[model samples]
Every structure is written in structure tokens, then in C-alpha cells.
Target chain A: MSEPSAPVTLAVDCMGGDHGLSTTLPACARFLQRHPDVKLLLVGQPEAVSAGWSRLKEAAAIPAERVRIVPASEVVSMEDPVEIALRKKKDSSMRVAIAQVKEGQAQAAVSAGNTGALMAIARYVLKTVEGIDRPAIATQMPNAKGAATTVLDLGANVDCTPEHLLQFAIMGSALVSVLKDNPRPSVGLLNIGEEAIKGSETIKKAAELLGAAGERGDINFYGNVEGNDIFKGTTDIVVCDGFVGNVALKASEGLASMIASFLKEEFSRGVFSKVAAVLSYPVLSALKKRLDHRRYNGAALLGLRGLVFKSHGSADALAFGYALESAYDAARHQLLARVEQRIQACVMPSPGAVA
Target chain B: MSEPSAPVTLAVDCMGGDHGLSTTLPACARFLQRHPDVKLLLVGQPEAVSAGWSRLKEAAAIPAERVRIVPASEVVSMEDPVEIALRKKKDSSMRVAIAQVKEGQAQAAVSAGNTGALMAIARYVLKTVEGIDRPAIATQMPNAKGAATTVLDLGANVDCTPEHLLQFAIMGSALVSVLKDNPRPSVGLLNIGEEAIKGSETIKKAAELLGAAGERGDINFYGNVEGNDIFKGTTDIVVCDGFVGNVALKASEGLASMIASFLKEEFSRGVFSKVAAVLSYPVLSALKKRLDHRRYNGAALLGLRGLVFKSHGSADALAFGYALESAYDAARHQLLARVEQRIQACVMPSPGAVA
Candidate 1:
């Protein structure tokens, strides 16, 4: 960790997510109280940011020196086209927050806005790490073992070659190693089956790359694993193309929501059931706490030179705070440097790079 | 449905699945007792079939005229290569069972063996429907509303084109119509997002084909749906390439299993929790029964000329019986004829035939 004279700062896009200011400002206030050593550069419309600050001033002991209002004239709506957001919305809160990272005013940026727009803007300003073909969205999924498994390329680069998957595996491993404090975190190539012969040509070729990398001590490759293995926590890191990963993640979220609703409906059925529900409320709540998606809200946009994290657009105050915490952790642990070193060591140079 | 002069017969691959004869024989015996009008032709080695019949005679009341024994010297192990099973294992139980449909000896074939081998053998013996590009695996997923949503191309054809997906939607609609007596079953094109611009070119093209088909009254096409929509019962049928469908299905299975185990673990944590668990036992058991994967056992291999159902490999007697029951229902409803009619009506002539 680097000991700097200046406080580590994080630029947060306050005009993002579902309930923009209501969620982001309160979450930032809570975060500031929790982390005395860190400061926040709240990037959004000046009036809204000032109004939020005044509302939270006394209750949150608004640290005047620790918080700064970075004015942004425009906002990026969730439905904005990536290209339009990149070119037109130059002073949007998402862009301004990312610019803080680019201009060295803040160590990292966090946004709970349009994923496509955020990625496009971040890539345009910060660019990907040197040897990395594309940036991947890495997120934590709570597994059956009560630990989180890191999965990457959730939906950033949809069409990936075997080389890109291999890069994902290495980057995911590095992120996991730093977060979990484990040097040799195992990485699993997400395939249709555990058998070597299964899956598309791309997945098979990716398997070969990961296997060879494992042998060379670049990554602790755990061979091929299926979709079920992701929840089973079969490995520390699960790697796949953005398309498959996105489908799997969304499907999982869908199923989890359905199951939770079903449980709620069943428990409220009758007098006897209601009584049982009341009696078992503690256990149910405990289980709910364990499986809460909010606990795993922050997803790091890996492979970029400047650190950035994406929060769920629908996240509330607590969930948004978790995203800020995640970005703060990444910036504090030198995640970008670790990812760069690992990518440089493992990933083969692109054909363009060779040229 | 055509009223057959004789009893509807189903060919059973006795040497398939994990337990081979042990699981299939008992399941078949149970099925026979439950549905007296249905007969089974047990295909396997003569000695094993005879031994199983003798063992199940008194208990299951083995009807002598209804059951037949077909001797086959070879067995297709789950790990065997599809090509080898197709060529060398011509006399294998799986092949013989499918051949019964080819030779018009049975209305349908049921196998709990290797999927690749079954698809290969069935396609080779029965051939694809004239306009169909490839066969797909259609399975039922129980939803919140206590109805099954039919998802197709589960793992049958890994790589699929727009035309192939269009064919799957037609066939799936026909299957649901016959099974649930719902003529206009809504089919959703699975994608990363519900937006038109999201997903790959292949999915985009498939969506266009489905939309056109829906306009022509060939099938009911719902717009794009995310993963969660599968369990939400958003549509009657969810169509995608084999790879995405397979991943979604397996991941959901893994999650369901994990959630069950977690519930059990939490409820048994302490004395107070254990008492609460006992009180909530009925509700828990009801939930378990509702979400039971065993209840949704059979997966029909669709788009072939003749009817075939693939049972889960590790299914026990009860689960295997469910598979047999599914095949019997399909035969009774004439699912194959319905599928063929739908495909012929919607699908364009194959290039081979057109030329």
C-alpha cells in the first residue's frame, strides 16, 4: 500500500441509479462517517449536491473538509445510447466522476448509472491497461459455501476470443487474490460441462490457454467448470465470455427473486402458517441476510487503467454504500497495479501489439 | 389424436441411464401397473430383461402380453463417443429402442442414457423433419404459477441459426399446445436485455424471424426476456441457442439445490431454531414438493421425425417412471404429428430440397 500525504479521494456520480440524490447522498454521508481517512468528491449538479449536503449536515456531522462538490452540468439517463453518452454528455456526472480519476484528483470512481454508458465513458477517458484487449465487468456472487466467488466479463465484451478469456481468468484471479488475501486463487473456465470435450471451440481453446497458464504458475487454473459450479463455489474465479456470463448472472438473479417471493407468499397462507412464520422469522431473516444481493452489489470494471466500480441501478442507500466501499477497497489495495502486473505476466500480446 | 386399434406401445432402453436395468425395469413395471392400456418393449440383453421381469412379476403384476423382450448385445455407456455409438453399437439398447419408432413398432422411445448418443442415433434412424435444420431438446421448468414453461434446444444443437431457433419456437408451441391444451402458447426469445438492440446478431435475427412467425399466426412470440423471467413464468416457451439455455438451466438447478441445503442448515442451527423448524416442517415440505426437480424429470428431444424423450441420467425409479409417463402422454396426444405439422406449415424448404 502506498502512504500518500494527501487523503485518498473517491469521485461518486450522485445523479445516477434509480433514486439518484436520495440514495447516493445519504449513502455517501454514511460512508464518510465510517471512513475518516477517506474523502469524497460528489459529482453532480451543484444545487442538488448542496441541498443534499444541507439536509444531511447535522445528522451525519457533514465533514466540511472531507467532502467537496464537483459540479457537472449534465446527467446520463439510464437509457442513453453508449455512443451518445460518450460524445454528447461530456459534462455528465458519470463522465465528470470518471474524469476525476483520469485527472488524478481522485483515486477511483463509482457510478450506479447506465452500465453501457459508464463503460463506454470510462474506456474512452481512462482506457484499458496496456496488454489488455478489453475491459471486463467483474462481480461477486454469494456461493453455497458462504463465501463470494468472483465472476468476470459479465457483459462488457460480448464477443471474446480464447485469448480474451485467458486474460479474464488472469485478471479475475488477481482481483480475487487481492480481495481475499490469497496469493494463489483458483480460476475455473465456465463451460457447458466439466468434461474436456464439451462446449464451443472458443471455450475449449480457452481451456487450453488456462491449463497452460496454470502449469506456468501464472494462474491457478481449475480446468473446466459448469454453470452450476458458479453457485457451488467450485473455484475462486469463474471466467467466460460476456454474453454467457451476462445471461447466467441475470437468470440467477431472476430465480433468486422468484424463490424469495414464493417463500413470502407461502408463509402468509393461513393462520397456522402465519404463526409458524412468526416463530421462524428469526431463522428466515438470517437466511435472507445471508442471501441478500445487496451484500454483493458492487461490480468492478476490471482491465481499465483507472479504477471504477458499477453499482446496481436499482440499489438503495445501503447497497450504494457497499459500491462506494468496494471502490474504496479496490483503490486502497492497488487493484489496478496488481491487475496490470498479472495481465502483463500472463496475457499474450495482441496481434496489433505485436505489429 | 388418432385412435390406435391396438394398445399404445413405448420402447424402453433398459440398459441406459446410471443404474441400467435396476432403475428402468422397476420404473417400467410401475408405469405398466398405473397405465394398463400402455405396453412396453424392454430393449436390452435377454438374460437381464428376463431376470428383471421375473423379479417384478408378483409385486408389479407383470402383464405377460403387454411386455416384450428385445435382445441387444451392446450397451452405449454414457462416456462413449457419439460417432462410435452411432456406427459400432448398432445393436445397443438405446439404438434398438429408437429403431422401434423407425420401424413403426412403437409410438415413442424413452431413454435415460447419454444425450449426444441418443440424439445422434435418433436423428440417424428417424431423420429430421423435412424443413427442420436440426433437432432440439425441449424440457419443462415448473414456474411460480404451478405451470410448466417449455424451454427448447437445451443442449441438442450447441450452435444454432435464426432459422433453427424459429423452428424450435414452432415445435415448442406445438408441444405446449398438445400437452397443456393451450393453442397459443407465448414464446420468449431469451436475451441479455429486453431491449431490441441488445444481444448478438444471431439472437437479433432469430427475434425477427419469431416476430414474423407470430404475425403469420404460426406461433405466439413475446418480446425479449431476461433470465429471471424463466421462473417468473413470463412466457410459455423460452427459446435460445443450446449453450445459453444449458447454462441457465444448470445454474438454476445448482441454485435450487443450494437454497434447499441452506434452508435445512439454518433451520437446524439451534434448539429454538430446531423447534421452529419442526413447527414449520409442513410448509418446508410443501415448498420442497413444489420446487422438486424430480417432478420435472422428462426432457423431450424435439424436431425429429418420430417421438423420443430423454430421462435424467441419475433418475431413480420414481423419476424414471415420470419420464415414461411423459412419453406415454406425448404418444397419447400425438405430439410428434403435431410438431411435424407445425414445422411443415411455418419453416421454409431446406436448401437441399429447394435446389
Candidate 2:
């Protein structure tokens, strides 16, 4: 991990998510304590953020000068559509937070809001980075190797062409190289089977493009990987269409929660089981902490001209804090510049390097 | 569950899978002991089936008359391509076993062979049932309710049209209604989101067709469901294109295995934890047994003229026994006729009821 620079500023949407100010305010307070040199542009209703900030300033030991409240008249509700958030609610906290990055007031923006609205606003304001057609949400899933596997197009574009898949691979490689400090991370194209003739026509064509790209040394392309490979850590980045990736992500969440419920039921079935649960609590808790998905809460909205990270809509204080920390890391590590350079080098090669 | 009829015969592919006779023979022996009324037509090289049958005969207490060895000149190896297994190896065990169903000698067929080869042979021999354009593989996945949720198109048709998905719903409905004893089981169209306008164009169109089918009372259709819905037991059946279904299934398998490994690591890290592991062993093992994937081994190849069940290639004796019992149950419950009736009633409605 690179050392945090002295002047990395983040614009956070405080009036977003289910808990809104309740979760965002406390997470911001704790985040500031950990990163003393970081500056924050809190975009929300001025009164709410102001009152909460004054209350937390003394307790958190964060100087009043290091924090700023950017006024936003409207709060984007969780159910707000993309059109409403972008065209109608122009001054929404979510949009204003992103505007802070677009206007060069902050290095990055963070939000725990409606995903569609967040993506819409970010794309509208910051625009796409050169050589990218559509932006994708890239996030890390906990893998068997005890490390995270990056997966892209989590829920951004439902219908992706082979070209879009290739773009996702380029952007994902850049994101991983910056975030994980791995320059040549391997990319796996998610498919039903590992063979070339295994998936849909679109996927087969995508395989050809990815294979060619792998030959050119643009990406460390790992050929077709199945669904399980995402959790198996078979590759550093698994690229898929938004529809499939979204299904896989939510399915994992649903299964994890169900297993948790099952574990709870098994441990509390009766007296003997309850005693056993108490004795094994520490070991189990450690395992739970090791595999805590909340620690990987921030999903980068990659392929955009400016940096924006999305937090899960139902994140708690600890989870939101992790989101803030990830945004900080991305900004400190210069994720935006690296994404642009990678896209330029790989997608728009110089005349001499061109085929 | 329906009781097995007096004369239900199943054609077994004795020379498929990794262990060939080693796993298939032992599983068959145990299966016969439990299913007294069922007769087996063991399809393989006559000499091998004869030798294995004679060795397992006295110990398994099976009447020699109940088991018959049918000669197949060649065996369909795991690595064989569809073209090879179909045209070249016409008398292959997998093909010959399926031929038994075609010739009306057996009510059903079971094989643990190369999936592509088996599907090709089954489709070539059995043909698609009246209205079905293509065949689909439907299997049960363990859910939190201590029951299984049947999902269709697991790895059969990677690129399914809207009509193909609708057909899958009909076949899946019939499969569940017959096997699970639910006359009107709800069928869920698997999508990225729960909303009506959530997924790809094919999914959206499939939803409209399914909604119409639900209105006609041909099949009980649940609206759009996410990946988690499968394990949540949100519906009796979940339908998707094979690519998505395959990815979801394999991803779940990977995640489950990873969690198992994680549990072992945590419980054996130290001496105290080791002792704690012993104390929690019974509870954990009970949980494992309750959610064993092996128990859900058999995948029925639906939309065919005859019934054919595919066991997991790596299934052990107990799991293979379950596959046999499932195949027996399908035959006893008349799954093939029920599927035809459902398709005829739904797809080819009467002239008076035409839209």
C-alpha cells in the first residue's frame, strides 16, 4: 500500500442510503481520525451535516478547517430513478458530491445511494474516459485464497457486446493494477465452460478478442472461466455482462446470509448446542471477521474520466467507513490517471505500435 | 411421493464416468437392494457387466433374473466429442442405454458420462417432445427450507431465445409437479433484478410470455427473481438460459467448498480450537448432511420424447443411489407423459382457445 499523500480530498454524499445521516456522519468522523491529512467536502443538506459535524468535531479531534459542508437542497431517495436524479433533481446531494470531483474540488467522490442514480450522475457530470464506451462497476469478491477477486460490470450495463467486454477488461486491469499494486493482473472472461466453443456467440467472439489482446500483452488474459472461478481466485479480474455479474453477486449474498441464518439456527437449537457455540465463538468470530464482505464495500465506477466509488446502499457505520477508506486509497494512489493511461496505451496505440 | 410400480425398468450406462464399473456397479448393487420392484438393463460390454453382476449378486441378495446385461461394443469416454459419440460410436454404452428407453424396454435411462455427448445422443434418439424446440437440463439445488429448488437449462442451451425460456418453464413446471407432488408449482424466471423491466431483451420477452402463461393457468408463474431466490426457496422452480444457470450453479459450488475449507482452517488453527472443533463436530456434520450437494446429484434432461437422468460425473455410491431413486420416482410418477400434457396444453392450445 502506498503512503497517503498530504492533499487528497474526498466529496462524500452524506444524505444517501437507508440510514442517511445516521450512518454517514459517524463513518466520516471515524475516517477523519484515521487519515489526518485528508480533507472532506460533505455534500448534503447544510443544516444536518453542520449540526452533526459540530457534535463530532470535539470527540473525533478533527479540525473544523479540514471538513467543509457543500450545500445541496435535494436528497436523492433510494427509489429515485436515474432521470429524476440527473435531470430533475440537479442539485441533489448525490449529484453535487460527484460535481465536486468533476469541478476539480475533490480527488474523488463517494456515495451510499441508489446505484442507478449514482452511475447516471457520475457519467453525466464526469463523462467517460477516452477509449471507453460505457462505464462499469468493478468490485472485489472474497475468494478462497483469502484475497479478493475483482469482478466488473456488477450491475451497470445489462446488455454488453463483445467490444464492451473488451473495454471492461482494459479498465478492470487498470483498476486492479492501481488498487492492488499489481501491474500485470490476470483477467478471466466469465463463461459457462472453460473451452472456447462453450458460451453464447457474443461470448465466443469476446474470447477471440480477449485472446488477441492477451497475445499483444495488453492484458494477462486467462481464458474462459466458469462461475465458480470467481470465488476460486482463478484470475485477478473476472469480466462478464452486467446481467450475469449482478446475478452472481446477489446470489452469493443471498447464499451467505442464508448460511449465516442456518449457522445461527444450528448453534441455538438446544442447551448442549448453545454451550458448544459459546466455546467456539472466538474461532468462528475470527473466521467471520476474516471473511467480512463489508471490508470490501466500495465498488469503483471504472472507465470514467473522474473517480467515483459506490458503497452498498444498506451499509452500516463500519461498512461505510471502509468505503470512505477505499475512496481515500484510490485517490491517494492516482486511480483516475492510471485508468486513462492504460486505456490510451492499450486501446488507442500510437501509429508505430498500431496493427 | 408415488410408490414404485411393479415393473419399472431403468437402462443403466455401466461404463460411463471416471470410475466406470467401480462406482456405477456398487451403486447399482445398493440401489437394487432398496428398490425391490425395479429391474435393471445394465448396458455395457456384456462380459464386464456379467463379471461385476456375478461378484455383487450373492452379497447384494439380488435375483439374477432382475438384472440383464445388454452388449454395447464401445464405451463413450469422458473426453469424446458429440460428433464422435453420436455418429461414430453408435453402439456406445451411453447411446445403447438411451436406446433402451427408445425401444420401450426401460421407462427411463441414467448415465454419468460426458454431458455434451449424452445430451447429443439423448436429443438424437429421444427427439424433442411435441412443442419443445430444444431440450433443457433441470436439477434441484439445496435451499434453506430443507428442500430443493429446481433450476432449468443448467448447461444445455447456452443461447436461449424467449420462446426457449418459455418452453423451459413448461417442462420445469411439469418436472416439479410430478416429482415434488405439487400440482401447480410456481415457476420463477431468473433475472438480474426483481422488477418487470430488469434484464436482457430475451429475459424481458420471456417474462411477458410466462406472465401470459400464468394468466391462462397452464403454469403457476412467479414474476422476476434474482440469483439468491434459488436458495431462498422463493419459488418451486427458477428458469434461466443455460449460460447464466451454469455459472450460478458452479459459482455456488465454489463458494460452498471455499466456506468448508475456511471452516476447517479456523477449527484447526490451535490446540484449544481443535478441542472446540470436536465439541462442535456433531452440529457441523448435521448441517453438512442437511445441505449436501451430493444428495441433489441427478439432473433430468427435459423436453425430450423419453426420460433421461444425468448423474454427477463424480458421484459416489450414496449420491448415485439417490440418482437412481430420483429416476425411479420420475418413472413411477410418469414425468414424461406429464411433461407432454403440459406442453400440449400450454404451447399448442386448442383452436377455440387460441390467442
Candidate 3:
């Protein structure tokens, strides 16, 4: 294994996110201020980036030389289709930021812009690794065990074959190893039931592939896991196609919102309940920290040739800063290269030789 | 509509559930003692039924004539496939109970045995309603708004066409009208987003059909709804294919379990939380009641010719009672007849016409 080096540089799509440069610039500034070794390349409309830089300079003692702005006239709307990468929005901030990674001008790229556009631009410019058929967005979710579980293909490929699922499992396993620092991370096939005969033909085939892969010691396969098993941390990596993964991710978010709203309503019902809530404030804050997405902001677009990270479009400065840190981690860990090697090792016919 | 007469008679599979006759018979005996107007036909092994009856008599004061034990020598195991309904388990309690519904001896049937067996038996005997391709299971979930939303195809068919989705929506709409007392239930197609073109081709087609159905007043159709919208009561009836619906249902269950476990762990940390918990016990109890599966049992297998309902395999007496009540509602409301009439009124020359 290679020794960890100095902090990596990240190219930020400064004109992205709900608040655009207002959120992205301050987040970059905060991240840079905290990590002295790291540097930033801000890609956006020149005027907006300059205005954001000036505002940050007034508020904080930011080292001016550590940051540089790359002018990009176009800004992809979050609503734009993936086609925006091909034609009209070629020079968009999102595209240019991704290009910085592809061109090796930056170690990694972070974008809080349109997810589809970012993915398309990343794939179009950086391309996929030799063995990966489709790149997947892998996100970390906080489990009840007080640890994070990796859920992949959050929204990459809509339709997936068994082979695609196998690739995702392999990539996710490598990712969990790097992020969670587990030498042999357990991989689980997400399904409706834990039984072998359950789930669709696609899932069944994926299970068989996982079984074969596990036997080869390429990845640690924990067999089938139901939706409920995700929070239990039954496995370090939960693999599924993009459609189910997307729905599951969104459903979890919706549920968290529902529970939060319910809790607030219950606590505000009467004077007694309000008083109880006051006493429970510390515990509630602890619980909120456990569920907070800011701590797990960076979701790597795994299986791609270059390291690319996606932050939530609605992410604030704190979340965006974490996203930058995630990109740095991926770059330092050589995540892309490690994933490629893992995929190559698994795909070969003679697994014994690789072992 | 006809001033619901006497409570409907339900044939209970005495040799069902994890504990078989031990749990089923006692539950039925207690239920009968509570609802004197209702009758039950208990089907199972004659010896087991007799033993269960003797035990029931000792525990509760129940009239013998109100409950009759029908002799069925066989029982369906939880692991058995749907084929058990066809060849092997001909005289099983699960089959006989369903047969009672078909023979008009029982208004509905309740089985806590294998889900596949119940669905198969119901389809084989009760048949599908005219113009209905396949039956769907519709389960009610507690929304954040304090009202219940009905989600269909919880686990019926894995693959569904746009037409099938439309049919499920229509049946689900009719169900909400009868059960929720909504004169014209608002229906929504469950999708990744609320936009008209947000989902796959199948979803887009289903949306068009729903719009047309809404236009003709065959059903009150709201547009697309995302996963988050399910708990928001964005629409009274949320419809999707069995595959997506099943995933969504299980995801919600997982989310609830996750939150409950998290809260439990947080509250158990110290004495202060224990005091706060006791003070807020009433509010928590109310919340639990709202989210309780017992209050939300009886997922109707809609579009079938008869009133067939599926209860949770692990359901207790309270949940079984709710299933029985739902069956009664479906039977008294003539749910099947209403669905048949609606389909006949809305069937078009081209499936695209409704779309």
C-alpha cells in the first residue's frame, strides 16, 4: 500500500447548488482555511466567482493565493437533461470542473449542481475505467449501529443487468474498504427477502455472481439482505440497481423528514411535553447529529476513470465543505485506481491465479 | 349503501400462523366472544380443532353454534410454493377456508398461512373480475397528515404494463371510496418525481391514462407523486406496479424500524431520558398507535371477483380482527361489482385513449 501523501487539491463548481456561489465559495473558503495543505480551483462565471471571493475575504482571513478562479460562462440548470453535456452547456461550470479532473489539473472534482448533468459530464469527459460498464454514485448512510453503510447506484443507471449489479458490488466493496478502512468489507445484495429464491431473476443472478466472487476472495459477500437490514449494518455494502437505490434513498429521506416533523409536533403539543423536550434537548441533538447528512456529504461517482464527487443540490456551506473533504480523501486513497484493479482481478477467468 | 346488515361471516383457517391451531383457535374464540353478531367457520385437522375448541371453551364463554369446526386434514407450510394450492394441499385449511368464500358459506376468508398459497387459492376459486388482468394487494399506511393513504400492489406482480397500473389505480380509487369514505378518492401514480415526464416510458403512459380517467370522472386522478409524497397524503390512493410498490412498502417498514430503534437507543442512555419518556408516554403511545400494523391490517387483493384479503403472516388477534373487519367492509360494499362496472365504463378501443 502507498503511504498517504499531502492533502489533495479539489476543483469546485462554484456556480452550483441552490444558493450558487454564495454557498459554494464560502464552503471552499472554509475548507481551505481549515486544511492549510489543500488548494482550490473555483470554476464558474468569472464575475460571480470574483464577487463571492470578495465577500469571503471580508468575512474571513482567507489566503488569496491558495484559491484560483477558472472562468466558465455557462451554468447548467439543475433541471437540465444529461444532453446538456453534449451540446449547449459544453462550457458549463459543472462540465469545466469535471474537465479539470480529467485534464489532471486537479486531483478530484466536487459538484453540487444537477446530478444528471454532472454524471453525464463526468462520464463524457473522464470516461469509465477499463472493466466498469457503468459508473455508480455511492453514498454513505448512517446506520443504527452508529456507523455508516455504503449504498450504491443511488441514481446512475436506471436499467441494470445482473452483470452491471456485479460490477457495482465489486466497486462498492473496494469503496467500503477505503472509506470505512475495513480490509475485507462484507457485501450484501439488497432484495425484498433474505431467501435465495426471493427477488427478481436479475437479483437472483447477481446473488450467484456474488457467491462466486466471494468464494474467490475478491469481495466479502454476505448473501441476501432485505431493506430493513440496511440500518442494521448487516453488511458494509448494500448493492442494487439505480432505480431501486434511488427510490430507497429518497424514501429514507422522506421517512426521516416525517419522523422529525412528528417529533416536533409531539413535543409542542402541551406545556408538559414542551418541558420534557427541554430536558431531552441534548439527546435529541445527539440523535440529529447521527442522522445529519452533512457529515456524509460526498458521494463518489465510482467506476469512473477519474475521482468525481457529488454533493446534495440543497447542500449548505457545511455540507459542501464535507464534500470537498470527501473528494480529497478519494484522491489520496487512489480510489479510482484501486477500484479498477479490484474489477480487473474479479473479472478474470482464473481467480486462483489472481489470489 | 344498503344499510350494512349483520356483521359478515368469515371462515378462519384454524391451522394457520407460526403456532398453527395454538394461536389461531384461541384468537378466533376470543374474537367471537367479543363480536356475538359475527360467525366463524374454523377449518383444520379435526383433532386439533376439537382440542383448540376445548381450550377456547375453558378460557372464554362462547356459544358452540356460532363457530363450527370444518374438518381439513392438511395444512400449508410457510415454505410451500403456490403450487400447494393446485395439487398437494387440496384439502388444506387454507384452501377450504377460501372454498367457503367461493361457495357463499362465508362472506370472506382469513388465513395467516403462506402468502403465495392464499393468493393462489383465492385466484383459482374466486376468479378475477371482468376486464381485470390480475389482482393487486392494497395496504393502508399512516401519513404524516394523520390520515391513511392506500398504496397498492404491495407484493402481487413483479412486472406490470401501463394498462395494469391504470387498472390498479382505478381499483385502489374505488377502495378508498368504500373504506375511507372519500366520495371521489384522489389517486396518484407513484414515480421518482412529480413531473409528467419524470419516469420511465411505462410510467408516462400510465400518467396519461390516469389523466383521461380523471377527465371522464371514472376516478379522481391526481398527477405524479414522488416517494416523499406518500406520507404527505398528496393523494388518497397511490398506485404503482407490484415491484415498485413492494420495494416502497418494505422501505417504509425499514425506515420506521430504523427510527424506532434509534430513538430507543437514545432514550435508554440515562435516568433523565427515562423520566422524560414517562412524561411523554401518552404522546409516544398515540404515535405508536397511529403507526401500528394492527390498526392497518387487511391489504385487499383488489380486482378479484371475490373479497379476498391478505393479512400479515405474523399478525396477532388484533390484526386478524382488523382483517376480518376489512373483509366485511369489502363484502358489504360490493367492492368487486363496483370495480367491474367501473372497468366496463372506462375500457377504451385503444389503451392510449384512456392514457
Model 1 clash pairs are A254-B228
The residue-by-residue lDDT of candidate 2 on B1-355, one tens digit each, is 7475567899999898877888888999998888788899999999998888799988988998899999998998887777888889999999999999999999999998888888989999989887777889999988888788999989889878888888889889999988888999999999875222268888888889899989999789989899989999999999998888888888888888788888888889899888888889887898677667888988999988999999888788788878888899999888899888888888533232243
How many clashing residue pairs appear in each of the predictions shown?
Answer: 1, 0, 3
Candidate 1 positional error at A312, Å: 0.9
Superposition error at A280 for model 2 (Å):
1.5
Q: Candidate 2 vs candidate 3: which has greater DockQ?
A: 2
Q: For candidate 1 chain A, which ten residues in a row score worst on lDDT?
A: A346-355
> Which 10 consecutive residues of model 2 chain A have the lowest summed lDDT?
A346-355
Candidate with the greatest lDDT versus the true structure: 2
lDDT of 1 by residue, B1-355 (tens): 4455556899999999889999999999889999879989999999989997888967877669989998888999888888889999989999999999999999999999888889889999999887877888999887777677789878877667888888889889989988888989999998875121378788888889999888888889997887877888999999988888888888888888888999899898889889889889888898788778778888998888899999988899899999998899899888899888877787453462354
TM-scores of the models, in the order given: 0.97, 0.96, 0.94
Better of 1 and 3 by TM-score: 1
Q: What pairs collide in candidate 3?
A: B208-B355, B209-B354, B209-B355
Ranking by lDDT: 2, 1, 3
Per-residue error at A216 for model 1, in Å? 1.3
Predicted candidate 3 versus true structure: per-residue lDDT over A1-355, tens digit per residue: 5648676778999888778888998888788778778788999999878986988866778777778899999998777776755578888999899899888888899998878778878888998877677789899988867788899888777667787888888899888787667889998888764121267777778889889989989889998887767777788999987777777777677767776788789889899989878877876777677777788898899988899999999999999988998998888888878887887778533222234
Any idea what lDDT model 3 has? Answer: 0.79
Candidate 1, residues A1-355, lDDT tens digits: the string is 3443445799999999878999999999999999888999999999989998888967988658988999999999888888778889899999999999999999999999989899888988999887777888999888899898899988887768888988888889889888788899999988775121378888878888888889899999998888899999999999987888888888888777877787798889988889889989998897788778898999999888899999999999999999999998888888888888888777463553354
Error of 1 at A280 (Å): 1.7
Per-residue error for A312 in candidate 2, Å, reads 1.0
**DockQ values, each candidate:** 0.59, 0.58, 0.46
Query: What's the ranking of the predictions by TM-score, best on top?
Result: 1, 2, 3
Question: RMSD per prediction, one decimal?
Answer: 2.0, 2.7, 3.3
